[model samples]
Target: MILVIDNYDSFTFNLVQYLGELRSDIHVVKNDELSFAEVEALHPTHMVISPGPGLPQKAGMSLKLIEHFYQKFPILGVCLGHQAMAMVFGGSLKQAPTLFHGKTSRIYHEGKGILKNVENPFCAMRYHSWIIDHEKPIHSDIETIAYTEDNIPMAIQHKKYFVFGVQFHPESILTPEGKKILKNFLEISYDKAHPLH
Candidate 1:
């Protein structure tokens, strides 16, 4: 099962739909709809923090919950969720010099990990005003997987944990091969659920 924590993002429904098409078992709830205990009752195999408007620092409750759940389960944070993950894990965020809404940028990434089979310098759909501060010292376990030409962090993953985040929206129509990126994420969760060793 997958638990989607909606942060009132307009794309929340689309994300749920995409996952539902991939897996029959998935649940989506607003960030405040369920308490931590209630979320535990659902037994979600993985969690997805959806994108939303505004700064992640202001999302006090969601950030706290995500911090508590990190490393305990696989998490895929999108946009605002990505920022929230960075902030929760000792990284910092600052307003981008230029806002990116419905814009496409080439994302240079490693050819492995969550971006396996994804093209390097792939065009990705971006929609956020804040970005991860690469200068800040993030947790050692965190590995930056992708970056924009301007040197902004575009994707990240926990080196030893099944946690990942993307600054761009892989579910958006503007992103070519978007579904493939999402499929990679599902595969990660599947591997976690059915580890070979």
Candidate 2:
């Protein structure tokens, strides 16, 4: 089963719809509503942290979930979820030089992990005021995999775990390759969950 942690974002359902294409067992819970013990009972094979308003510090259960399952299962964080993932591992966030809400930007990526087989400089939909600070030193375990034309960190993955984050919203119709990007993540999660398969 795939567990989606909703941060009260309007786009959460859109993300969930994409996930449903690849997996039938998906569950979404509000960030502030679920307890860790309750989450554990669901036995989620993979987790996705949805984008939303506010800072990572105030993301509630989403932050705690990453800290707990980053090593145990695969995680994909988008926008606010992306910020929370970085902050959990010593990365910092700052207000973007230009706020991008319901906008599109070109993303240059290393074509690794979730970005594997994706276009190197694909256009993606963006909607956020803050981003992972590029000027500061990122955590040793976190390897930046993608950046925008403006040099903002757009995607990241943990060095030794199946955790990943993308500043762009793959669920948005504005992103032409949204489904492909999400499909890659589901494949990664499946491979990690069933190593022998």
Candidate 3:
């Protein structure tokens, strides 16, 4: 089963619907209800940190849950989730020079990992004021894989794990290749769940 931690974003249902289209075994739980024990009880095959409001640092418990469970399965972080991943890994987040809310922006990515089959310079939906600081990567295990035209970290992936984060909301219809990106992540989770098959 796939578990999504809803951070009370307006688009939480959109992500849930998108994942449901990919697989019927998708579940969503509020951020306040998140706990390592509860997550373990559900036995989710994969976990997705949904886009949310406020700073990632404020979601202290959720970050800890990610840190504890990330190594157990393939995890994907979206927007706020991306920032949460960075903070959990020792990276920092700060206000963007310009905040983006419901805007389409061109993202230049190297087509690596989650962006593997995605087209270069893809147009993705942007909706956040905070970004992961690229100048200083506090976590040696994390690597920024994509950036915006202005040089903000657009996408990031773990150096040696099936974990990734996208600053943009891939579940939005506004994103040119949103579904494809989610599909790629679903495949990753499948591979990990059915390893050696």
Highest TM-score scorer: 2
Candidate models: Cα lDDT each: 0.83, 0.88, 0.85
What is the model-wide C-alpha lDDT for candidate 1? 0.83
Q: Could you tell me every candidate's TM-score relative to the true structure?
A: 0.92, 0.94, 0.93
Give the per-residue lDDT of model 3 (tens digit) for 130-176.
Answer: 99887776678788888988899998888777788999989888896
Name the regions of candidate 1 deviating beyond 4 angstroms: 190-197
Top lDDT hit = 2
Answer with 1 or 3, whichever has the higher TM-score. 3
Better of 2 and 3 by TM-score: 2
Candidate 1 lDDT, 1-197, residue by residue in tens: 88898998889998888888788798888886788888789988889899988887665357877788875778889999999888888999888988998899999988656788888889999988899999989998787889999999999988767788999998887888678887877777545453211
lDDT per residue as tens, model 2, 39-109: 88998888999999999888878888999888777899999999999988989999999999999999998
| Model 3 weakest 10-residue run by lDDT | 188-197
Better of 1 and 3 by lDDT: 3
